[model samples]
Target: MQIITASQALMPEGWQSDVEIRIAADGRIAEVGPMTTRAAHHLDMLLPAPLNLHSHAFQRAIAGLTEARGPDPADTFWTWRQQMYRFLDRLDADQVEAITAMVFMEMLEAGYGAVAEFHYLHHAAQGQPHDDPAEMSARIIAAAQIAGIGLTLLPVLYQWGGCDRRVLAGGQRRFGTDPDSFARLHAGATRHLRDHGHADDRLGVAPHSLRAVDAEGLDAALALCPESPVHMHLAEQVAEVEEVMAHHGARPVTWLLDTHDVDARWCLIHCTQMTPQETARLAATGAVAGLCPITESNLGDGIFDGVRYLGANGRAGIGSDSNVHIALFDELRTLEYSQRLRDRSRAALATPTAPTGRRLFEMALAGGAQAGGRDAGRIEAGAWADLLGIATDNAWLCDRHGDAALDTAIFGGHGQACISDVWSAGRHVVQEGRHIHRDAIRARFRAAMTALEATV
Candidate 1:
């Protein structure tokens, strides 16, 4: 058992001060109160570490490489994807393990206690199935294990390139699958996880998106993992929304909500192009709207109506998709800034005297855990013992206390502050601002990237 005290912490309503949290060996919170008499581990800025609700782990390495536009002046997500295809061809199982470990390390340091990896790169470059169908998925799982981050391994079912069963293009080959192949691969990946996944690590299903998967395939994947967390890329781009409306006679989320019983079990990533009616209907579904504000901005994707959606009481969380940026503060800050820009208002995420940081943290934490199928995202008894520490000793945070500290961290601060310690499932993965496996993981990552540079 361990009890750590905080000068400030994020509780249900706002930042509470002089709080103590007790963690049991089984990774559950033993107790949380104003004070604790228990003897054990201690931390400084203890708060609920937010879950990274969506990621493609391998994209971390190639993040900066896609900045240059092609011959066309207006390159977009479709254009950037060509670079990604070439990047993945350089990765085998061993290389994937190296890359994934580094990615998860960055995530852990970025205050993500857990990740819901939307893994799709499975087959070889030519689209041929690997000897082990889940070879790539296992590599990602291994990376999570190495990093000691909670894992929700979502094996994506990408059945088609379009509405028709069209053969995937050169770059998409690695992510292709028929429904039956996908089902088999998903099962193998699940079984592999049962053997090697980290404790508290779990499995889930991703239908890639409506475009990458057909109706029947999506239905089957959902049925296959009825109880597991279901994630899908929704309306991120206007182009995608147009395509969905063209094919399905409705927007993606609109069609899905009307067709399927989308409850709390689902997480719809990106839902950027919702109509007023669709937004209202979606808010009633109780599903998490997984938003990647920074990534959305980078991809030239439009913003989701955060004000309208939250006003409707919709659950939402953030992710570091594309791995272009991996800072938790950046994601949260960008989210609020986007909303402010859209609404043309100041202090968009803030209330009269309430802390915007606390509210955003609470919403993201709650929604992220719900999306990842975890009994966490809170500093309460029965919640998992996941906490992140910030360095109050820093000059920028001087004289700040309680909610103001969080306000500084999330809104005022721009880059990584001294994250002195990070505890996942009551175990310390980072101490003194460094990950336990940072050195080793980084070595492997260096070697992997060197090899990748040779090919890509």
Candidate 2:
């Protein structure tokens, strides 16, 4: 049992002062209330860190490597994917593990207590299954364990090359698997999680995308995990939307909702090209729009219809997709700023009463916990003790308090520097604005990158 006191803490209702939190032996929050007295482990401010609803862990390795323009006049998301495939072609399990650990550490330090890893890089460099079918997934699980971050392991099912159901092509072979093969892979990943005593770790099914999975394949994969959270890359690009429309005679989001029983259990990443009707319809389904603003901007993907979606009472969360930048505040700030730029207005994500920062932070916390299938995102009883202690000393947050503190943190404070400490399920994974294993993880990642660079 452990007790923590904070001068101020963000609760579900609102900010509370002189807050006390009791962490249970099993890492769940047992109780919370006013402190009995001035506790020693006192913090200036505390907030429940949000979960990252979508991430491609291995992509962290190639962050700044894909910025160069090629011979194509129109550099696009499709071209970026080609670069990604080329980069991953040489990645092995150990390198993947190192890079993933580094990413998870960064996530924790950046005020994300948990991550939903959309893992899809299966098989070997030449697209052959390793001796242990779950070898690569084991690497991810191991990395997450070492980093001490809550993980929702999403085993992806990728089969076809596109909406046309073309056979897996070069640079895409490693991610291909038939329904039966994918089922086995998913089951194997689950067993590994259980055997490692991470029984509470979620196992979700990802059908990759509408373009990658046919209706039959999607149905089969969803059937394999009925209750687990389902995530997919939705209308992220204009080309993808057009392709799905050409093949299915409906927009990607339209075809998906009409075909599947999507609900609160589903999270659609990057609805950047959704029509207004599609946005409203998707919002009505209680599914989360897993927005990765930094990545969308990096790839020049169009902005999501935030005003319209929020007007329809949509659920949404932030993700560190592509991991070019991993700061949670940056993701939220980028999301709000994107809408602001589009509408030519200030505070585009603001509600009537709540400020933009508080509103975005609260919505992402709730929606992200729902999407990740984690018992977190709140400093309340029964939630995991995934808390972040915000440093009051940050020059940008000097005179702020309550919601204003959140505003400064999100909009003005330096990335991760505003976060003083972080607890992941009661483990003090980050302190003094650094992960406990930051140096080791960074060193391993540096070595891995060095070796990879020599090859590439």
Candidate 3:
């Protein structure tokens, strides 16, 4: 049993002072209240931890390496993708585990209690299925298991390389799968995570993107995971929107809403380039829009019209899509900054009643839980006890209170002060702002990168 006392903490509806929180043996939140009662153990500040709604763990290594322009005339998402493909030339199971472990460990330290890895790198180096089809995915799951972070293992299904259903390009081959092969891979990943995700862990599915999946392929993959959260890349780029319009009659988001029976179970990653009509329609579906601000900014994907979307009461959450920098603060900061730049206005993340910082944090928490298919994201009984603690004594946060603390964090505070401690499903994965597995995971990562360099 564990008990934590916080000078101030965000409970379900609002912030409470001198709060007492209790955790039972099973990792579910046992109780939450004033610090009148005591337990076997107690600690300081606490808040529900943030969930990372999207990630491609292995892509963490390729972050800075892909910034250079390729031989292409115009460098864009496509050009950068080529660099990414070239980088993936020699990632076997061991390398995948090492990189993913380090990535998850970093996320834990950064106040993200859980991660929904939109993982699709499934095949071997030559685009062929390994003796075990889900060999790579199993490695990803293993990394999360060893790192002790809450995971929503989303095994992605990729059938085609582009809108034309062309054969997968060299790097694309690593993520391709037919329906039967995908079913086997999906099953294997689920089995790998079944026991691991009871009170603390989770699992889900991602159909890489509309461009990478055909109608038949999408249907089959969704059928296999009837109840798990299903995510997909909807409209991240202008070229992708154009491709979807050219191939399907309408835009990608419009087509998905019109064609399928999508609801809260779905998360549409990036709806960056949605039309006005497409935006309202998606809001009506009750699906969460999975946004990745830092990665989108890095890739120059156009900013999402968050102000319009929020006005429609559409749900949305932020993710570290490319794992470029795995801080929950960066995702929130970039999301707001992108909106501010797009509209040239201040407090764009604000709702009508609440302050901007509180609103953005609450939405990401709520929507991320939906995206991850978990019962979490707030300080409440019965919800998974995933919490993050921000320092009250930080230079930027000093003399601040409530929403001001969060606002200062986005617009003033450094990343380190904002991330003090993190808890995942009632377990303290990060203590006093450090991930317990950091050093060991990072050592393995360095060794793996060295090995890959030799292979290259």
| Number of the top-ranking candidate, with lDDT as the measure | 2
lDDT of 3 by residue, 77-112 (tens): 888887789878788889989999999998888878
User: What is candidate 2's local distance difference test score?
Assistant: 0.90
State every prediction's TM-score relative to the real structure. Answer: 0.96, 0.98, 0.96
Listed per candidate, the RMSD to the true structure in angstroms reads: 1.7, 1.0, 1.7
Clash counts for all predictions: 0, 0, 4
Clashing pairs in 1: none
Clashes of 1: 0
Give me the displacement of residue 163 in model 2, in angstroms. 1.3
Better of 1 and 2 by lDDT: 2
36, model 2: CA deviation in Å?
1.5
lDDT of 1 by residue, 1-456 (tens): 877877677776667767888789888899888855423445546778888999988888897898888987879887887778877666777887888888889988988888899999898777878988988888888888888988999999987777656778876889988788988899999888999976688898999998899888889999889898999999888888888888889888789998999999899999998888888888899999999998899888898888888878889998887888899988999899998898898667766666678768887898999999987888889888778887777777764777777778887773267577888888789888799989999999999889888875
Score candidate 1 by lDDT: 0.84
Q: Write the per-residue lDDT of candidate 2 for residues 1-456, one digit (tens) a residue.
A: 888899999998898999999999888899999999877678889899899999998998889998899879899988899999898788989999999999999999999988999998988986888887777888989999989998899989998999888998776888989999998888889888888635346778899999999999999999998998999999999988899999999999999889878999999999999888898999999999999999999999989999999889999999998999888999999999999998899999898899999999998999999999988999999989989998787577895789888888889847468788898888889988888899999999999999999998
Better of 1 and 3 by lDDT: 1
How far residue 60's Cα lies from its native spot in candidate 1, in Å, is 0.9
